[model samples]
Target: MTSTDATTSMFERIGGSDTIDLLVDRFYDRMDTLPEAKTIRAMHADDLGLIRDVLKRYLTEWTGGPKLYTPEKGHPRLRQRHFGFAIGDAERDAWMTCMRGAMEETVTNAAARQDLDKALSGLADWMRNRQ
Candidate 1:
């Protein structure tokens, strides 16, 4: 890693709040339209407004940005929160399909995008609760 990369958080490396917003927006847009994403998309509410804001806050905190999520929601028991969903490899893949595209679109820094992709992939895998 470069000296700057070592010092900077992923949030800063990926362009902070603005890029995060773009990424989340693009991800949801993909989820809304992509054929492969239909099943996962059905898991969400008809009105995506609340979930969109929640995702923005969660990603902001997750990418080493400000503590935008925890102050209100506390430690993210992410799996527990998602236990209601029957997530498996297909669901994970569908989520990643949206996220990878969003990352490619908004995270201009190549290294940061790769790093975020790996991390997100892991997180998505962990989110899977079904066989």
Candidate 2:
């Protein structure tokens, strides 16, 4: 199903929790290995386990799936949570590159991919805290 199918949620259109987990995994894998992501990757812990779970929950909820995140972590307060990190243009771009790669690999629906691309780009740009 596609997001255009109003009967379906973005989460369902994108293949539910399993797909979200895979996307998060692919996203972090790219971030962990790509030279372009090295700077941003350095800000993360050596082990991605915790962040991976958090992201899975966040994405699940953000995509109109079950409200699994806020119940566990309260408000996302995303910008505030990321304030300590110096998220500049480079960081945002690298992050988007990873996400784009993941989405390309996992999301089969053209419209769903396009929708996510637009939404995620805006969200990533919003995360930038520096010039």
Candidate 3:
């Protein structure tokens, strides 16, 4: 049977810093090149390195790993932080396309990928500010 210990964080289940790094890297790489991600990609800076590091840190703390992000950033303020960008259904869908591809390529466990996808969908939807 699969280990379902309550104490186990998704961070641990998904591997660790290395896996998070790989996932973030793959995510941005997809966003950088995928034709489907073109619109969403335009929203980001040409240099993805900074966003990549922030995401890695955010995901680390978000998934119950060490508190790396909050200590530095105070709070994620996800929606407010994204307010500058006009996120709509198309943008959210495009973002999800890259994320889904990244998760599929990086996450080996089916159950874990499903869980991440569900949560990511909600978060991405919430980021949308436009109709």
Candidate 4:
């Protein structure tokens, strides 16, 4: 499921920190406005500033760019951290809707986008806390 190797990381393929910032910002923007994302959107705070920063750091490290997340936040026990939220198919789809659009806009590399989509889809599905 990993995309990084000795040559280049998925982070570099998609333009590193700049792309991560754009992707996270766009994702939150969609979640804040999309009707289909209402259910999941309500799970976040009115000000997305904090979460946006967190997500950028998380994605940066996840894509092998830097250790921004873990150094500050510790191991990404993502599911555990999100256990307070009730996640299911609808929530997963809504999250993916936001993410796919953000990736399309920010991650210019086609192959990198596809690979990222696949990986993130699995992560979103695994985040489900309900049936």
User: Against the true structure, whose lDDT is highest?
Assistant: 1
> For residues 39-127, what per-residue lDDT tens digits would candidate 4 score against the true structure?
98899998889999999999999988889999999999999999999999999999999999999998888888998899899999999
Q: After superposition, which runs of candidate 1 have C-alpha atoms over 4 Å from their true positions?
A: 1-4
TM-scores, each model vs. reference: 0.96, 0.95, 0.93, 0.94
Candidate 3: misplaced stretches above 4 Å? 1-5
On residues 1-131, what C-alpha lDDT tens digit does candidate 1 reach at each position?
A: 34668878889989999999999999999999999999999999999999999999999999899999999999999999999999999999999999999999999999889989998999999999999
Which candidate, 1 or 3, has the higher lDDT?
A: 1
How displaced is residue 91 in candidate 3, in Å? Answer: 0.7
Instruction: State the lDDT at 117 in candidate 3.
Output: 84
lDDT of 1: 0.95
Ranking by TM-score: 1, 2, 4, 3
Give residue 44's lDDT in candidate 1 (0 to 100).
99
Q: Model-by-model lDDT, in order?
A: 0.95, 0.93, 0.89, 0.92
Per-residue lDDT tens digits for candidate 2, residues 1-131, read 34458788889888899889999999999999999999989999999999999999999999999999999999999999999999999999999999999999999888888888888999999999999
* Top-TM-score structure, candidate number: 1
| Model 4 clashing residue pairs (backbone) | none
Clashes of each: 0, 0, 0, 0
Q: Report the error of model 1 at residue 128, Å.
A: 0.7
